[model samples]
Target chain A: MWVALSYACWGISIVLALWMLYDWFKIDTTYSEEMLTSSREGELEAVSEKHRI
Target chain B: MTIAAEPAVQVQGDRVSLLRVLGPAHVWALGVGIVLVGEFTGWNFAADKGGALAALIVCWIVGLLYTSVAMIDSEVTSTVAAAGGQYAQAKHIVGPLMAFNVALFLVFAYTMLEVSDAILLGDTIVAKAGVEGLNHNSFIAATIVVLAWLNYRGVLMTLNVNFVITAIAYVSIVILFLSVSPWTQGAVLKLNELVTPGNALPYGWIGVIAAFQFGIWYYLGIEGTTQAAEEVRSPARSLPYGTMAGMITLLIAAAMTWYVCASLMPWEYLGITYYPLWDAGKLTGSALLENLLFIATLLAALASANGCINDAARAWFSLGRDRYLPTWFSAVHPKYRTPYRSILFLLPIALAFAFIADLNQAITFSILSGVLQYTFMSINIIMFRKKWPLGSIRRGYTHPFHPLPAIVLFCLCVVTFFAIFLGFGSQLIAMVAFYFLISLWFHFYRYKFVRRGAQFTMPWPKPQGY
Candidate 1:
């Protein structure tokens, strides 16, 4: 019975963590800029040329 | 029109085409898939008796530190984005030999883990079906065959399958938890007991440290998602979020599960053989619910295997592309557009390990290799910070205190390296010796045969501002 209960709590915890992360992403739009520079001039062109399909 | 000769290697190129393969959803699925595997295996139990609370805290801290590293990886991949992610990054940052060593350790680690997951999948399936005297080797072989087929189909197909499997895994875990929780009689919820060391370790700061070391395994493949950075759409945005989200979700779920298990059941009853969650389901409900939980375990094992295989193939593909291994290993299927040769090579190694070894030995080898990889990654990040300085790419998610967490993680890794020796005795020594021998072979082959008397060049261009 305890084992079942514990698993339930664990499940709830996962849901909550996912929720928090979602909110964190929503609040900071600029967070993506540091990791990605696609909008910058010459960068996208360079990437396209390098990885031509 | 002038006739042009077709290149012998159609897929052999400087960069991978992101349009043909991966996207944000695939990236998210891969990250979550890796985390689900860690959680499904009763890895939380490994952290249980050894100061569970301390381990939990350290896991969160480590998650933050890894976030920084993930961002770094994202930045690096953007600049030199290729199919061979880590090997390319390592070669660019350090040198060819160092990159080769890192890639070698990763291949050994990931291959061992894939085999271990396959064996566990067989165990889960057999036990759930109430089948006795099942041919374990045959089951392992079959599982590897199925996994290899999935790999052969290509990344998009693999990702789709992974998405479905992960969804089922998440839903089942939720159902298992909800169904069992209502029946608990007197489950005492005490957080204090987690800190008090008992059978797992002696009571001291070292015990706390030891607990953290074991707990790190639960978060082992968190950074693996970064290997797919180049494939993701706008990786600068998706990579950090996906990696951190996956890890944070895993952390919370693991702690909650640990607490529930520790509080609800007596320590003696929750033995190593019986899965605590499944046992709880049996106690609370009918045979049907028990069967459901059993099926859930099977699905979890299968998903975990899939995730491990994907990561392992990518790592080796990167190595082959960097010319650290035989060039043939870099072959991608013409139609499928996946790392076919690398996947084929990995299967035999994984299958052999699965058939010959028991779960404990396989896990030990995997964990040891993982430790080496993590240590090297942490050191590389520090080196980049020092040497690159102003030229180092900006991080989307930075560790709160510059270098402190990195230092702490490094120290934890060093202690864990020693702990493996102490904890596992002769096995640890044998593995380390084997690793050194492999490293020695690479050194000789590269220096004596390939680049004789040439000065060793670091993988990446030296930063101008350093």
Candidate 2:
């Protein structure tokens, strides 16, 4: 019975992991554009400040 | 409002290099946990019981050859730094048809492998728990769904989990080896058995070759570290280093595990059962040890399965991005930054195979498809060297011998392909037929349907300064 439960748990864990991965990917891809643009702006600002020095 | 000229908007590429995305330890963990266990268990089984010393020698040679080819692959990636890795290289140096074929084979192979790993995990759990009449199919199906869910979350989460799981797996192997050590009654042959011939090649040279071919399946995802190159920090250096480091770590772990297994049990006893490692653990005379080993195997399989899903989803994303398949596959979730569509697309395929196919059939199909893809990638290295010559300075890692190992791997791949057909029977034929039909469908879809009377040309980038 323990073995059976282990098998079930193992199966369930994988399904849970997959669901989690999906949600993670969804979040990453959705915000990527905004994140990329903001990061670029920050870099440009840093570059301009360095040149002013 | 004055109609002033709009401020120039500078757009920077959001793409990440492969090295920046991967830490050395993360790469090491993946190499040890994900690649090693997946390749080693079955490899040692074939080497010790099925092919004997000849098989072991052949595999070592193959391993070295594979390592060399991987080095060449690093050079290719460094030069192009393209998203698709092998697929991109094949298309650029060869043609779209070849790239499409390689991509399709890779996706199918990895998908089958993920299901197979899940099934093996289920089996290990069942064995340890001493469970009878377990529905293997349902268990596998459930596991596939779980794996899909994990990957759907994102790469970072998967990697983080993989790191923990890999640590557990290493500990398990160590405990298993130590636990089983007391069982040796001076009966375990050491150096002598390395060369001693027995039923190891039960079916003679043909069988030995076939076993070694199947054994190569264990090493299937070693190149996967390269897949994450876009995320790594300094891909030119790190990609090659990470890849080689991962391979070396896996080789050591595998050799250690195999040596321990060989030292603990008689070859004859090892050959009698499929779950030999678990059996060895049971000989420790401690129920707790048995349970621990079982849990460890499950964790190893889980980590491997998770890694496989991540690799497969990314490959699918690359395929879609390159317009090789439907554009929807390239769809990243607006919020998640993940290839949401591709992950969703792969779940059903993996789950269907897990539930529908028998375990052995699924494993055989996965191995055969993997061998086919590896063959192409190995050959592509040699082809690239000749077609696109490097200048005086070697930028990235170069293969030690210019074309020798690559040539040998190519030959080995061909031998393995034929051997798989002979050993695997009808499934081999079905897989080949499936791949060819998929290729034809893609070709037609691209030329006749999607392009619709437009001329089909190579998807080559315009030369700089043109």
Candidate 3:
């Protein structure tokens, strides 16, 4: 049981990491640097300094 | 009228921001969760350096050091309000060079700690299963990846999970303390264990000094609450309250853990063992207590690893955002609004350290990084007050007894460094050389990339001295 669980953990982690890599590249290609770095929500929040839902 | 300046960075695309959903409770969980794991394991090394009584004494002394750290961190973090915590403070108060080094310190400190936590969890599992020489790599990788995934998803869910697991571990310590019933005549605790000859101070006063480095285990990383400064719903209020509350909880927890363990086992045994709390539970001969402690140890490791992911990623992301590393690292997840790239990037680094498998070596590296950061903190706050004196800007919280805390903090950091030298001298020199080299790299290559104009995010008046 323990060995199987360990193997399962290893399998799950590799899958998750691969998924993250795929998403990371996809996002990089899709968004412009200006769009990516400029934070719309952060600007509004920084100015007001108020909590938002 | 208040100054209404343009956004710190200009852009031509849709907006993305980290969720501002955290409150005081989440802040407490973030800080305590990262640190409570120490109570279960690494802290007993202090007994090895001195003795049981010496460990207790050093615990209080180190407690005072962290109290100073919390107070100073709260004041600056409350006003600066950024993700990198001390890195952001260093940028505004000192300069880019100092900020770069501080950011690196925060990254390494958390990452090494995460590695140690994962290794401990893996070893515990193998031991419990009665297995011999099983490879722990898979479990270590699994632990980092899982926590990194959670952090990538969102901060709220990540910290909420931490809060639950951290609370359980804390309550277990309290239960163990009560079960020992030190106040009762037929108590399980052996008060004589403390005063038994060499147990009090075997190596004498110098030993007490030597114990200072490990004493930090009792309350390391409590200042990490400030790393959540950006995500907090109200930094001004939540940062100070959450940080102080976490400090108080750690002091109480540290005292009780020492009392329970020091009383149950001989000083020599307690000093050398990695599973002091669990061993104490076994001594009680209560099957329930032993199992509770076993589970608590596991959960505490998980909680610590989880918080380390959140903090290390934040500091690294903040550096990327400032162009100190690469702007590629700065991108926030469009949907999750988390620093997804930074989280994923650190996964491999954490795994590499975990594979090293020397828990003591890993912890020493983490502690030294932390000590350097704390030393810089004392300097940063002194400069902060000098540059922007009282009434210069709207400080969210102001630390009392200004130079006193800073002075004491600086002095304590010096003593801790000596303690580290006595134990891990070569490692100390290696870390210093490492930072020194990085500082050079930043001054030459990296500084060219940093957008200096945009570095100052706060809209405060001109600094008085600068």
Candidate 1: C-alpha lDDT: 0.58
Tens digit of per-residue lDDT, candidate 1, span B291-375: 7666666666666677778788877876654456764565555435456567767877887788789876777777787777777
Write down the worst ten-residue block by lDDT for model 1 chain B: B1-10
Query: Who wins the lDDT comparison?
Result: 3
Clashes in model 3: which pairs?
A40-B15
After superposing candidate 3, which stretches have Cα over 4 Å from the reference?
A40-44, A47-51, B1-13
- Give the Cα lDDT of each candidate: 0.58, 0.60, 0.87
Query: Regarding DockQ, does 1 or 2 come out ahead?
Result: 2
TM per prediction: 0.77, 0.79, 0.95
By DockQ, the candidates rank as 3, 2, 1
DockQ of each: 0.03, 0.15, 0.47
lDDT of 2 by residue, B1-466 (tens): 1122212222234431111234555555554555655532455545543545434554565576567656767676665444445665676666677878877766776777787777787666566556566655655656667666655544555576788888887777776656544345344325345334564455677666666654564466776665564444455677777677777766655555655655555655554445555665676567887677677767777777777777677677767655667655665443233565677778878877776775566667767776776778677776666655555334566667767767777877777776676666577788788888877887767633333112122233432232
User: In model 1, which runs have C-alpha deviations exceeding 4 angstroms?
Assistant: A1-53, B1-20, B42-80, B179-208, B268-271, B286-289, B391-400, B447-461, B464-466
